[model samples]
Target: MGVIMEMNFNEDDKYLLAKKKVEKIKGFYGNLTSFILVNIILIFINLYTSPNHLWFYWPLMWWGFGVVIHGLKVFEVFPSFGKDWEEKKIKELMEKEKNNKNKWQ
Candidate 1:
């Protein structure tokens, strides 16, 4: 089995956490830009090449869904679920497991 490394986070780690969020937002914007450009080109091509069928909406709908999810993840809407939430959940589960082990013993 591979060794598992435990994460030890400190208050100073907030900066690193913020940096990661910034990176995520940056990536989301890049993806959004690409989505717009590619979809626009696809729309034009679909309009000119196969105007009867109009197949561009297929990729547009799917890719637009992805962009919306990416936006939610980057902006942390609805269910944010940040680092603090993760740490709290970890501690809660660890305590619960410890208690269960003690009860069994």
Candidate 2:
């Protein structure tokens, strides 16, 4: 037979978790805003300085990829690193700690 355990979060834990989530969202927005503003300036510079040979697309494409990944991670759009994965990892760590404590006792 296997023993089952349940984890519960108190009010403080809930509040902290919510705060962390909000911070991640804010950070993502900040990153996205920077990406847009910087790319706009790059586009302008490329056009004004060297319109004949364009090169702004290079940074735009690479930075856009990073922004997309940041957004996906913040929004939990990727299943591998989403909420389920976090919870599972937390539980696994807690179980490991419990076993170690038991062995010492």
| Per-residue lDDT value at 12 in model 1 | 80
Model 2 C-alpha lDDT per residue in residues 1-105, reported as the tens digit of each score: 123356688999989989999999999999999999999999999999999999999999999999999999989998789977888777788888888888899
Best by lDDT: 2
User: How do all models score by TM-score?
Assistant: 0.74, 0.87
Shift in Å, residue 10, candidate 1: 4.8
Q: Candidate 1's residue-wise lDDT over 1-105, tens digit each?
A: 122236677878968888988999999999999999999999999999989999999999999999999898778784538555676677777777777788889
Query: What global local distance difference test value does model 1 have?
Result: 0.83
Question: Candidate 2: misplaced stretches above 4 Å?
Answer: 1-4
